[model samples]
Target: MKTLLFCMLGLGLTACGSSPKNAHSNQDELAMLVGTYTNGSSKGIYTFRFNQETGTAVPLSSAALPNPSYLVPSENGKFVYAVSEMNNSTAALSSFSFDKETGELRLLNTVPTLGADPCYVATNGREVLTANYSGGTMSVFPLQKDGTLAPADTLFQGEATGPDTIRQATPHIHCTVFSPDRKYIFATDFSADRILRFVVHPNNPIPQTSPEAVDIEADSGPRHLTFSPDGKFAYLITELSGKVIAFSYNDGRLKQIQTITADTVAARGSADIHLSPDGKYLYASNRLKEDGIAIFAVNPENGTLAKVGYQPTGIHPRNFNITPNGKYLLAACRDSNVIQVYKRNEVTGLLEDTHQDIVVDMPVCIQFGNYSARTKDTKN
Candidate 1:
């Protein structure tokens, strides 16, 4: 019955009268793991189960850790990597072996990030990368074959600073992400106002850091980045200036092409950026003063963005994710301790609140994966 409803919806027949509960019947159970700051009622990381067909979710299980502020699962889904967002002279990245079926996690190992206040983590199935905010460096850890993280392999430290007196007094590496093709890595430095590019060398332990860095507008604190599905374009969100910049990506380099403000009335605390799976739209979050998501329509021809609209959200939307099926958007409101779920309109690229909020204290990151209800042992 759910399969038939899904087929009808795919055929553009809304009159088929399919209910939300049956929307995801054709797909496997959608599992989401949320990372949160530990200062509130939250302990560490929490898991939630959802029906993609119904666009709804409920909390499942949680594991205790210290300041698990950022998380990224391995490419094969066998492991989850998280960063201890601390600033007591040093920070660490912890590894966990994930059990997809039961939504459980076991601690594998933890290694010093060789820096202070590590904020972001990314991997290419072999190496784990982290961005240290206070230390102004990027830490690299090699992932062992058995889901553990090796000791620090390298630390790429930045020496530059931007024009902002208070915020840009020193370097602050905000995010570390890889190109979809896995050929390059991009690290955004907020205080330096630059995005450093590196060529991925799977054979060598460390990446070959490029000498040329992409410099954004002087005071724009480049925070996070997302690449278009086609890999021809990339979008960057600046935290200090509340702006989004569109760039042309090719051969391990970025060239800025366009710039736009995320919100004129909001404080400059732009946090995260992600593109729709279909590559038709881009979404960015605004924090601090105005809590909302600013939407933009992607121009397929020129890799540019046009402001479409904005949806107000809970306080401090630190991170968010668009469902793989492109039917929903989930925003993790850090300050409000709730995850706001919204239904996505594919045709217009707009969002409408579903009013299905998953309450978890100080939620900072949200990621989606698939799990098997039958076997509970399905890999990835």
Candidate 2:
């Protein structure tokens, strides 16, 4: 996979250009884009105007589609890619051209994943990757010159079983991630209890996989992953066991260093993990049981986690995001159909609910667009 900004630079496209003196300043207020499951009253993808200083959100616009469960925006915020998490014949990936000033999403194109329920999608700015959860495969799509993704040209499948017979009967790739340096790819193969690694081939669609980075705990069902700002650390949240595993990462090599449970990891549904922008705190979201956010303090001397606090959230907190300035945290509570906003206390590494909920239908993914993101890897 590759970068859209860099890709545009390579193709000599000027749409990626910025204003006066060629500067892209992150405005105080930016567009908040949410992806939702259409099983209920949800319309698909929605947008909001988010104020970074006040920690408040106001509804802006919405896009109608099927289950656009996960979304990944381009580095320049000019485009977004989302997964249509559906079955066999209907499952696909859609690309949208985003208007940063207006926060409007115009459909660019759609491509079949060839696999069912691609719950996760990732890109390195060159190619797009999808982790087909139901079909148990990893599919690849090259990026077109105009920002639309090319047709699915390659598919990766692994056959293995973990300790859990019911959930791990076959390979279930949940998330695909690129190394911080963007040289390699790492995938959380949930059913296999292993993190798969692949070497980037620049323009190649066929994956050249290396040895899996690390094997997860038996039946852990690793779901999502996040890296520290320095890229020296990586954190993974396991859905089945609801545990958070910390790792020391280098050159695409990840070493498991610590593992901690947030009261309930055994089938409680640990969904997403993220770190504060300052790299002081790490937060993990859980579902099915307490349905809250687990806050932990990160050790700077050595990458590890110590449980600090927990903030209860709405019904099924699927995916969440911390503001780039690290002033607030937002949780996409899917079942409750609302996005919960919480203020973060930097000193104690804790969260306080502000009672600010952006009501929507089954909001599963929350991402900030139309803003100059702090320089970091494109994490989803």
Candidate 3:
């Protein structure tokens, strides 16, 4: 019954040596690391050398693993972490030592998530968290001094249900992430249609704050969330409703302020959501009935979203990313086995296909490593 939710749910950086001098720079070279589902031809995690200068993505290397469906690099670019989306008791989370220069991943350590079918992993260089879809729990692990993971500190479970009997019968924790300030952890419960909030410290595991979590529209199936650049607002994408809801943020409490539809064809299968680096636009990808990316112009004043347009994507765009420079958009189409590249219109917030795609097997997550070869003086 839980394995079916994966198919039914529709979907869904850096180095210690040198810090990202600035968010955007004149250098246009970037390293794109991709995580994939290994049931297909994908071996594990793969890499591509992207040249935003020429709009091309060239295959680099890949590491073998069971099913590294999601990947997150450490803040200093020293290590990378991935969730093995497995259903058996062997389900676990793996850590890898990253070589920024070579764009390679070396398996560091693997630890049990203490839950089944772990689908999401998040880290802030201090603690690592995984949200297990089937087990309905969020597993917490301490980040070792050497980048390895400690034994599970806790397996927090949710017991809330929404109005829908079938999809919201039990807790389905989809995504867990730390807020920008690193003071709070937000975990989304899909079946509960709620976003769980917790207070966390550098040396302490997250403690559920008062009021526990925030309830979105019943049966909305909240999947993922991202905070505004200013940390004054939060945007949540509902997988079941295919809508993006905006909320004002104050001292860890999120107040719902606005909601906008993310798909015109259907109200389901909304996969991933992200904001542009410039914080001027919001984008969410939808699978199933509408395999496209929803574009929204962000109201800088009130943090509201106005649908601008929709760009058709490859089949099942489970995840995508914007280049660090905020000039290109990469859509990882899971079923199509290709990552489509597009030239982003900064002014209009629209994406135009660049026709330079990276072919891979079941590319579900796309992340850009902070490694760049070009110097600051390099020409774009």
**Which whole-number lDDT from 0 to 100 does residue 275 have in model 2?**
94
Candidate 1 on 217-259: residue-level lDDT in tens? 8889899999999999999999989999999988787888999
Task: Estimate the TM-score for candidate 1.
Answer: 0.90
Q: Is candidate 1 or candidate 3 better by TM-score?
A: 1
Using all chains and alpha carbons, the TM-scores for the candidates as numbered come to 0.90, 0.89, 0.89
Best by TM-score: 1
- From the highest lDDT down, the ranking of the candidates is 1, 3, 2
Candidate 3's C-alpha runs over 4 A off are 1-26, 209-211, 373-380
- Once model 2 is optimally superposed onto the true structure by TM-score, how far is the C-alpha of residue 379 displaced, in angstroms? 16
In order of TM-score, best first, we have 1, 3, 2
Q: Measured by TM-score, how close is model 2 to the native structure?
A: 0.89
Tell me the tens digit of each residue's lDDT in model 2 across 187-231.
888888878888887667556954455887887888888889999
Which window of 10 residues has the lowest lDDT sum in candidate 2? 1-10
Q: Predicted candidate 2: what Cα RMSD to the true structure?
A: 8.2
List per-candidate RMSD values in Å: 7.3, 8.2, 7.7
